[model samples]
Target chain A: MARRMLNQDLIEALTDNCAPIRPLPHPAWRALVWFAVSLCYVAIVVAAMGVRPDFVAKISDPQFATELAAAFLTSVVAAAGAFSAGCPARPAWERFAAGFFLLIWMGAFAVGCWRDVDAYGVSGLLSHSDIYCLPTILAISIPAAALILSMVKRGAPIAPFVTIGLAALASTALAEAALRLSFRQDPAVSVCIWQFGSVVLLTGIASLFGRALLHWTRRDALIASFQAHRR
Target chain B: MSELSDTSNDRESRWRALMASAQDGDHAAYRELLSDLFPVLRRFVLRKWPNAHDTEDVVQEILVSIHTVRQTYDRRRPFTPWLMTIAARRVADAARSRYARGANETTVDILPETFDGDGAKSEQETRDDREALRRAMAILPAGQRQAIELIKIQGLSLDEASQVTGKSIGSLKVGIHRAIKAMRQALERNG
Candidate 1:
C-alpha cells in the first residue's frame, strides 16, 4: 500500500515546537541520586517518628544487622534497575541483583519471624497493638514511589514492568527497613504479612498499570491529539 | 571478532556525533540522523518480520518510538543496539496485535451480522453505531479494546489478529461478544 506523505515534516513539528533536548544523566548516576533521595526520606521519617528506645538492643544481632544492610542494598540495586530500564540496550543485572538481595532479605525476615514464634507462640504473632504496621508501611512507600515515578517519566522504559516494579520495590523495601528499624518490630507471621505484604501487593498492582504510568510524550501522539481536537 | 568490534566502534562514534549535534538543536543533523536511520531501521524490521508487507507501518512506529525515547539515549553508548532493540520490539508488538485480531466472529455467536458495519446502514445510522462503539470501547477492558480494535474496526480476520497479538482465537471471539454486549447495553441506557 502506498503511504501518504505527511504534510508537515514531523521533524519540524517536533524540533521547532518541542522543548529543548535535555542531556540524560548516566543511569547509574540517576539511580544513585534516587537512592540518596529515598535514604533522606527514610531519615526524615525516622527522625519524625523517633527511634524506638530498644532499637539498639533489637539490632544488636549479626543476623539482624545483615537484614538491615540487605534492605538498604536492595534499595540501591533496585534504584539502579529502575533507572537502567529507562535506557534501551542497557544491562538489567542491577534488577537481577535487586531480586537476589530481595530473596535474601525475605529469608532473613522469615528467620526473624521464626525467632518471634519461638518466644511468643504462633497465636501471639497477630498482636492487636501492631495494627499500625499496615498503614505505616503503605504510608512510607508513597513519597518514595512518587519520586521514582516522576524520575522515570523523564525517559521511556522498554520493560515497563521492570521499571515500575523496581521503583515500587526500591521504595517499599527501604521503607520496610526504616520502619522496622525505628519502630522496632520483631517479625511475626502477621506482622511480616502486613509489612512485607504491602510491598508485594503494591508491586503486583504497579504491574497492572505499568503501561499507563509511563506515557510516552511522542510528537505523533501530540499532533494526533491536536488534530482530533480540531475535528 | 576484533575487526567486527572495530567497525562497530566506528559506527557508534559517527551516530553519537550526529546525535550530539541533534541534541544541540541542529535541525540539519536531526534530519540527517533520521534519514540515515530510516533504511537501517526498515531493514532491521524486515529481518524479523520477513513476510510482513506493511513494513512501512512498522518503520513509522519504530521512528515514533525512537523519538519518544530519544532523550534516554546515552551518547556515550553505541547507538546500533539501542535502535535494534526498539525495532525488534515494535515489530514483535505489531505482529502480536495482528495475530490476536484475526478472530472476532466465531460460530457460537447467535447474531453475527450486528456489529460488522455492513453497507446497508444509512450514514446517520453508521455515525450512531460508531459513536456507541466508541463510548463502549473506552470503557472496555484493555484486552477487549484490542479485540474490538483489530477485528471490529480494522476488519482484520481473527486468525490474522491472533497471529500478531498472540491471543487465542477463542479469547478474541469471546472478547468481541463481550464488547458488543457492553456497547448494546450502553446505547440502551443512553437511549
Candidate 2:
C-alpha cells in the first residue's frame, strides 16, 4: 500500500528544495531601491539629452517644480504600495495611501498644467520634441517597469493586479519626470493624452504579466522549481 | 474571531525560532515546525470551515503557502500575524474555488480529507500488499526467495534474518539483491 505524504515528509521536500531563506526585504526598502534605480536612469537620460536650455529659469517656476516633485513622489509612494501589496499583513492604511499619492500627484500635475496655459497655439505647445513624449516616455519607463516588477517578485504578492498597477504608476511617473527634465515645454491639455497613455499602457501590460508571475509563485509551482532543480 | 491567547504568543516565539533555523537550511527544524503548525492550522481552518470536509486540503495549502513565503517572516516581528495572513488568504482561495466549482460540477474531484487510523490513501494508492510480494518472491531462487519472503515481506532486520537463517549479513544482502532482480525479470516476462 502506498503511504500518504505526511506533513513532515512534505516539509522535508520543501526545505530540501528551498532557496536559502533570507528575509524578503521590506517593500519600502525595495520601493526605495526601484526609485533610486529609475532616478539613475532619468539622470542618464537628462545627461544624454541635456537639460532644457532655460532649465534654471523654467525649473525655478513653482508650478513646474510642483508637477515634477509630485510625479517623482508618486513613483516613490506607489512603489512602496506595489511592494506591500505583494505581501500579506500589509497595513490597512496602505491601500488608500498608495492611491492617495497618485491622486495628489495627478492633482498637482493638473494645477501645473493649468497654470502653463497661455492660449498658445497647439503647435507652440507641443513643439517638435514635445510630440515625442509618448514614445520617449514609453522607452524610458520600460526599464523602470522591469525594475519595479523585480521588486514585486521579491515577494509573492497575492494581489497581483493592484500590486502591478502601482508598479506601473511608479514606472510611468519616472518616465514623465525624465521627459520633463530632458524636454521641458509649456504644458498642453492635448500633450497629456500621450503622457497618461504611457501610464495606462504600462499598467495594462504589467497587470497581464503580473497575474502569470504571481500565479507561478504559488505553493505548487514553488515546490516544482525545487524539485526540478534536484533532478 | 477571538484574540490570540497568551499560549499562542508563547507558541509563536517557539515557532519563530524554528523558522529562523529552517530559513538557515536546517531541514530537521523545518520539519518539526511544519509538524507543529499542522495541528494549529487544522484547528483554525476547521473552526472557520466547520462542516467542510476539505479542511485538511486547505490546511495543506496553508502549509505550502507558508513554505513558499517562509522568507517573508521577519524575525523581529511576531510570527502569528504573518502566518495568519497566509492562512487567511489560502482559506479564502479555497472558498472561492469551492464556490466556483459548485455551480455546475456534480461531484468534487478530490475528496474531503478524512482522518483514519491508517490515513487516507492517495489517488495513486498501491495495491502491492504483502501477499503480492510473497507471490512475486515465489519466482526467485531458493535463497533469494527466503530473503525476500522473510526479510522484506515479513519486515525482519538483516541481523535478525542472519540469526534465523544461519546466514551472514553479507550473504543476506546478496540474496535480497538477487531476489529483487528475479522479481523484476518475472514482471517483465509477464508484461
Candidate 3:
C-alpha cells in the first residue's frame, strides 16, 4: 500500500540523521606535559646552582668558560628536542610550551648569576667595561643561533622566537651585572667571556627550539583566522 | 498546586500536555504529526524534482532530519516552516548532486497533450498518465529535469527557482521553455 511504503521511507530517513558517535579529543593534555617537563628542568637547574658554589667559581677560567658555552649549547639542543614533542594542533599547547621554555632558560641564567655575584663586584659587572668579551658570548651562542635560524626557516612564528631570544639576552646582561657587583672586581676578560658567551648560548637555544616546534607562523595564523570567519 | 491553579489556562494546559507526551517518547504522536504535515513537504520537493523518485527520496531525508533534531526543537514554536526549511535544503542538496554528476545526459519528455476536457477518464487512465509523466521525466537531462521540476511541478516563481538553482532567472526561463517544448515533441512522437 502507498501508506506503508511512505511509512517505510520515513523510517529509513530518520535513522540516518542521528548524532555522530565519535568523541573529540580533550585539549589539555599537551599543555600539561610541556609545563611539567619545563618546570622540572627549572627545579633541577636551581637545585644544582644551590649545592655548587665551587662550580660557579670554576666557570671563570677560560677553559671552564668554553665548557660552560658547550653546556649551554647542549641545553639549546635539548630545547629543540622538547619543542619537537610539544607542538600540536591546538594553540594552547604552542603558547604553553613557548612560555615554559622561556621560563626554564631565564631561570638557568638567574641561578648562574646569583651563584657568581660574590666574585665580580657590582660596578665591574654592570658597566660597559665588559664589552671586550662580546666575541666569547657570540661564540657560545653560535649553535643556538643556528638552531633558531633552522626553525625560523621551517615555519615557527618569528615574533615569539625573537621575544624569547631578547629575554635570554637581557637575562645574561643582568647576570653579568650581578656577578661584577658581588665579586668587587673590574670588568675583566673573564667577565666578557662569561656574560656575552651565556647570552649567545641562551638566545640560540630558545630561537632554535622556537623554529622547530612553532609552525603556526604569521601566515598560517592569518589563513586559520580567515577559515574560521568563512565557517 | 500550580497544576490545579493553571487548570483554567488553556495555553499552559496544551503546552504541558504536548511536552509530557513528547518527552514520554510517544513516537506515534510524532509520526501522526509528520504524516499530517507530509503533503506540504512533498509539494516543496516536487518543485525540486520532476519525477516521483527524487521527490520520494527528499521527503524521506527531511523526515529523518526532523526526527533526529527533534530534541533541539523548541516546543513553543510552530514546527511547519522549520520542517519545510529542512525539506528545501535537502532538495537543494539533491539538485546539486545531480548537477555535479554532469548536466548533458538527462532530458525531460512531456506527457501527451490529449487528455479529455470532460474529466471523464477512468482511474486507470489517470494512473497511466501519471506513469507516463514519471517515465518521461526520468529520461530528461539533469538541467532540463531540474528546470521542469522547479518551473512546472514545483510551480516556483521564476525568481525563486533562479535563487534556489543559483541560475539567472532569464536562463531558467529559457531552459524551462526549451524543456517543455522538447517533452511535448517527444510525447507526440511516442504517440
Candidate 4:
C-alpha cells in the first residue's frame, strides 16, 4: 500500500510539471507578405523609370553612379528593416532604425517626384497643372499605406506611430520654412494641410488596425488569463 | 577479453542502428524508443513535479516537443540526456505557470515509519508523526529536499540524480545522506 501511494505521488508530481504549449506565430505568412510588398514597390519604380533601353548608358560617370547605388542600397536596407518588424523576435533598435529610414525614404521620394515633374516639363502633371500638390500626396500616401500595414502587423505600440507622424509633419514644416528663407517663395497652405493630414490619417489607421489584429489573434489567451485570475 | 569487447561493440552498433532508424522517421523504431523512454521520463518528472494533476499534461507537451524537434537531435548522442533537457524545461515552465496561477498552496506532511503499519500506531501517534515529518521537511534546506526527492523518492541512482540536478555525484550523495539523517533525527526527537 505504501509503495502504491508512493507511485501515485510520483505520478501526480510528474503531471504537475508539464509545460503549457504556446502556438508560435506563423513566419512563412509574414515573409510572403513582405516579399510581395517589396516586389510591388520594385515594379512601381521600374514602371516610373519607363525602363528605357538606353537608360543604363546615359549614366556615364562611374563615381556618380556608385554614390547613387550606395544611397539606393541604404534605402533598401531601411525598407527591409521596416518589413522585418513583422518577425516575432525583432529588437527595439531595429524597429527604431526601420522607422527612421522609412521617414527619410518617404520624404526623399516625395521631393524627387515633385522635382521630376518640374524638370521634365510634364504637362497635366503636378508642375504644369493646378494640382501642384498631387505628386507629394501620391508619394506619401503609397508608402504610408505599406508602412502602416507593416507596423500594425508587427504590434508596434501607439506612441511610436504618433511620434513618427508628428515628426514627419514637423520635418515638412521645417523644409517649407527653409525653402521660404532660401528661395523667398511663400509656403503653400495646401502643402502644409496635406502633409499634416496624411500623417494623422496614416498613424491613426496603423494603430487602430494593429491593435485590432492583436486583439483578434490573442483574444482567447487574454480572456483565459483574466478568467484564471478571477478564480 | 576480445570476445567480450566484440560483443560490447556489437551492442553499441545495434543501439546506433536503432537511433539512426528512429531519426530517419521510422515510426516503429520511434515508438520502440519512446516505450523505453516513457518510464524514465515519468520518473524524472514525478521526482521534480510531485503534482499528479499536471504530470500528464507536461508529459504530453514534452512528447509533442520531441516530435516537432526530432530533426534537431543528433543520432550519435545518447537519447536520455536529450530527453531530460526537454523534460527539465517543461518542468520549469510548469512551475512558473503554477506560481503565476497561485496554485502552489498545498501543505505537504511526511510521517515516520512507525506510523506505517495499518493497526500498529494510535491515531494520535500517526498525526504526531505526520506533523513531525512536515516540520522536518520544512526545516530542511531546499537543496537537501531536492536531493531527497531525486535520490530517495524518485529511486534515481546517486550518479543519475547528480546528472539530472547538474550536481557532482559526491555532493549529491552527501546532500541526500544529510537530508535523510536530519529527517530521522527530527522523527526520533518527536517520538
Candidate 5:
C-alpha cells in the first residue's frame, strides 16, 4: 500500500511537471544542420590558418582528393549516426552508418602507403615527427564537439557511449579534413599513423565520459524540484 | 497468437494517442498514459532483470527517464519500439550499476567460528554491547531513532524511508547521520 501511494504521488508530481514540448526533428535533418554549421566554422578556421602552399597541388592528386572526400563523407555520416543513436528505436545499423566511409578513408591512406613503399623502397614512408597533428585536431574539434553535444542532449540518452563516440568521430574527422587543407603534412604513412590515430584516440577518450556527459539530469532535476514543491 | 498481436497493436495505438495528448500538456492524458505504462514497464523490467533487487524502483526510474525525454518521441513513428528501447537500455544500466555497487560489498551469510580470536567478543560481552546499543537507541530523539530503524536496521533506502515516514529524503539522510553520531557518543560514554 505504501509503495502504491509512493507511485501515485510520483504520478501526480510528473503530471504536474508535464509541459508542452516540440518533438525533435529527424536525425538526418539535425545532422545536416550540425554539419552545415560545423563546416562553416571549419572553413573560417582553415582560411584563418592560411591554406597550405601545396593545397592546390594536393587537391589535384586523385588519391588525396578521394581521401579528403572520404573523410568529409565520414564526418557527415557519423554525425547522422550520432544523432540517430541518441533517439530511441532507431535501427542498430544506423549506429554504424559511417563505417563504410571510414573504411574507404583508411583504405585511401593504405594505398598511398603501399605506393610509397613501391616507389621509394620504404624511404618515402618515413617523415619527421609531427606531434603537432594531435593538438591541432583537438583544437579544431572543440567547437564542433561542443555544438554536437548541446544538440544531442535534447534527445534520449539511451546509448550515451555510442552517441558520444560517434559525435566525437564526426567532429574529429572533420577537424582532420580541415587540417589537411591548412597544414602541409606529407607521407601517407605519417598521415595514417599520426592524424588518423589522433582522431581515434580523441574519440575513445571522449566516449569514456559518455555517461557523465549524457544522463538523466533532466529527470532528476524535475523529480527533485517536484518533491521539494510537495514538501 | 493473432489475438495477442491484435491486443498489442491496440495497446500501441492507444498509447501513441495518449502520448500525443500528453505532449500537448494535457495532464489527464499524461496521468492516464503513465498509469497504463507503469504495469507494462514493471513486467518488462522483471523479464529483463529477474535478479533485480527491486523491480518497481527500476520501473519508476524508466518512467522518469521516459518523461524526461518525451520530446524525443516522434508521433509520426510507432511508440512501442521507442518505449521498449528505452526500457531495455535502462534495465541494462540498472544491472550495470548493481554490479558496480556489489563489487564494493562482501556478503557473509554466517560468521566463521573462531577460537579466542582477537577483538572477538564473548557472549556476555556481546549481550552487554547489545544492551548498550538498545539504551543508546532509546535515548535518541524520535525522528533520529526512526531514521536508524528504517534506514539501517530495516535496510530501507532513503527514498523509501522518506515515503513511509512522510519526511523529505534530505531530512531522512540528516536524521540518519545525526542518529549514528549520537549512538556513537552514547556508546563511548557508556564505555
Candidate 6:
C-alpha cells in the first residue's frame, strides 16, 4: 500500500511536470547540421587568418588533398558518432563510425611522412619549433567545440566520455584542417607532430571532462520542481 | 518461442506509441507509460543486479532517466531497445555506485565509538569534586566566601566583584587570595 502510494505520488508529479518536446532528429542529420555550422565557422576563421600562399597548389597535390579530405570526413563522421552516442539504443557500431575515417586520416599522414623521409633522409623530417600550433588550433576549435557540446547536451548522457571525446575529435580535426589551409608548416612530420598532435591531445583532455559536461540536469530539475509543487 | 516474440513485438509497438504520445504532452499517456514501465524496469534491475536492496529505487531512477531524455528517443526506432538500453545503463550505474559505497564502508559487528580523553572524569568523580568544593566554600569566612563566589564561581573580575560587594578592588583581590589558600588547606586536611 505504501509503495503504491509513493508510486502514485511520483506518477502524479511526473505527469504534472510533463511538457511537449520535439524529439531529436536522427544522429546523422544532427551531425550534418553540426558539420555545416562548424565548417562555416572554420571557413570564416581561415579567411580571417588569411589563406596560406600555396593553398591552391597544396589542394592540387593529390596527397595533400587526400589528407585534407580524410581529415574533413573524420570530423563529420565523428560528429555523427558523438550524436549517436548521445542517443540511447542506437547501434553500438554508430558510435565507432568515425574510426574508419580516422584511420584513413592517420594513414595519409603516415604516407606523407614516408615520402618526406625518402626525399630528404631523417633531417628532412625535422623543422624549426612551431610553438603556435597547439594554441592556434585550440583557438580555432573553441567555437566548434562549444557548438557540439551544446548540441550533444540535448541528448542522453548514457555514454558521456565517448560522446564528448568524439565531439572533441570532430571539432579538433576540423580545426586542424582549417589550420592547414591558413598556416604553412614545413615537412609532413612537423604537421603530424604539431597540428595533428594538438588535435589528439585536446580531444583526450576534453573527453576527461565528459561527466562534468553531460549529467542528468533535467531529472534533478524535475525533482526540485516537483518538490516545490508539493510544498 | 514465436508466441513470446509476438508478445515482445506487441509490447514494443505499444510502448513506442505511448512514448510518442507522452512526448506530445499527453498526460494520461505519459502516466500509463510510466505505470507499464515500472514493473519491467524493476525486473531489469533485478536481473542486472540480483542482490540489489533497492530494486524499486533503481527502477524509479530508470523511469526518471527515461522521462529526462524522452526527447532523445527517435520515433522511427524500435522502442524496446531504447528503453532496455536506458534500463541497463541505469542498472549498471546503480551497481557501480553500490560497489563504490561498499568499498568506502568498513563492516564491523559492533559500531566503533569515539575515544574518551584521559582528562575526562567519571560522573561520580565529578560529583565528589563538586561536593568537596561545596564543603570548602562552607568553611570560608563570610567576606571571603562572598569574594570567592563573586570572583571565582561567578567568574567576575576584581573590580566587578568590588562593585557588587561594595568593597574596594584591592580588598576583593586579597579576600579571593585568602579564600583559595584556606580552601586548599581544608581540602588537603579532609583528604
Please give me the DockQ of candidate 4 compared with the native complex: 0.02
> Which tens-of-lDDT digit does each residue in B18-130 have in candidate 2?
98988888877887888888899999898777877677667877887887677777787778888888887787778876889888678768777764312465433334333
User: Over 4 Å off in model 5, which ranges?
Assistant: A1-5, A218-221, A227-231, B108-191
Two-way TM-score contest, 1 vs 6, winner: 6
Pairs that collide, model 6:
none
Top of the candidates by DockQ: 5
Give the 10-residue window scoring lowest on summed lDDT in candidate 1 chain A. Answer: A1-10
Q: Write the per-residue lDDT of candidate 5 for residues A20-55, one digit (tens) a residue.
A: 988899999999999999999999999999989998
lDDT score for candidate 5 against the true structure = 0.87
Best first by TM-score, ranked: 5, 6, 1, 2, 4, 3
- Pick the winner on DockQ between candidates 1 and 3: 1
**Candidate 4, residues A57-143: lDDT per residue as tens digits?**
524534223323433333334334433333323434644553454454345444544554566555313322224233443453355
Across all candidates, the chain A TM-score values are: 0.82, 0.82, 0.32, 0.35, 0.93, 0.93
Evaluated at residue A48, the lDDT of candidate 4 is 58
- How high is the CA lDDT of each candidate model? 0.75, 0.72, 0.47, 0.47, 0.87, 0.85
The residue-by-residue lDDT of candidate 1 on B35-121, one tens digit each, is 778888778888888988778767776777777678888888878888887777778777876777756535565555654555767
Q: Could you tell which candidate, 1 or 2, scores higher by TM-score?
A: 1
Candidate 2 residue-pair clash tally: 1
Q: Which candidate is the best by lDDT?
A: 5
Interface RMSD of each: 7.0, 11.7, 18.5, 15.4, 6.1, 16.8
Ten contiguous residues with the weakest lDDT in model 4 chain B: B67-76
Residue B134 accuracy (lDDT) in model 3: 76
lDDT of 6 by residue, A72-164 (tens): 999999999999999998989999989998888888888988899899999877866786899988988999999999999999999999999
State the lDDT of candidate 2 residue by residue for A1-231, as single tens digits. Answer: 112346666667776765567887877887788788789988998899898888898778776787678788888888888877777777856644656666765676566555555454334345233456667777888888887776677675577778877888888888887877777555544445567556766667767766656642334334434533454
